[model samples]
Target: MERNIYMNTITVSEFSEDQNLIFNRVKKTGIPVIIMDKGTRLAEIHPPSLPEKQSRKFGCMKDRLKIVGDIISPASDEKDWEVLKY
Candidate 1:
């Protein structure tokens, strides 16, 4: 009665017949169409993906981040911390 084919699939013949419409949908929706044949996945059709963002460089926030107090000194008195009662 029922088949096990994917819900988001398009047969090779259908893809061939309506390639223009399918490609237009792929371009507009950005969702890939899985080409199938007898429940076997054949190929995918969709627009090329774009990079999310450029890789960040080291020290790119060198001057952006603010620094305070002495660099080598402790932040607070050692006696103030109960965990350091060694």
Candidate 2:
């Protein structure tokens, strides 16, 4: 299981006192800031995830790959097999 990660935990009162600094840090680091209240988790402040790259989709490299004829055929004859030689 993945563990919860944060720059650090802060109480609600402390967070309220330094919210701007905390927010700026979270945005710059791209990590979460866990806010707690009375020893329990209340909320989290985090930066938004980056947009997905379009180049990762299937067939994105189709134009870059070149296949010659008879791709399904074997490159060598069956008589050349090591097991057959024995």
Candidate 3:
């Protein structure tokens, strides 16, 4: 089932006059507010949603990744690595 949420709509003048009140209301209640200017929507103000906590799963990408070459050995000869000595 899909649920629809309604947002409170207000004019620019009202928001401009009572910025703190409107902002506090939005923060207290999770509902968002639509700011309209001359009957057209100009902006929206809402509180940020909390991020969901996620657990790390080991080996989740097993077999999905490819190893092109030998990982245990260096790609080039030992003499070529002397460039970093400085």
Error of 2 at 40 (Å): 0.4
Candidate 1's displacement at residue 54, Å, is 9.3
Q: Each candidate: RMSD to true structure?
A: 8.1, 9.3, 11.2
lDDT of 3 by residue, 1-86 (tens): 00112338887778777788888878889789898899999999989889998865998788799988799998888778887666
**Candidates' lDDT values, in order?**
0.74, 0.77, 0.77
RMSD (CA, angstroms), candidate 3: 11.2
Ranking by TM-score: 3, 2, 1
Clashing pairs in 2: none
For model 3, what is the C-alpha lDDT against the true structure?
A: 0.77
Work out the TM-score per prediction. 0.49, 0.51, 0.51
- For model 2, residues 1-86, the per-residue Cα lDDT tens digits are 01223347888887877777888878988778898899999998879888987666887787898887888977799898888888
Q: Which stretches of candidate 1 lie over 4 Å from their true place?
A: 1-7, 51-86
Between 1 and 2, whose lDDT is larger?
A: 2
Clashes of each: 0, 0, 0
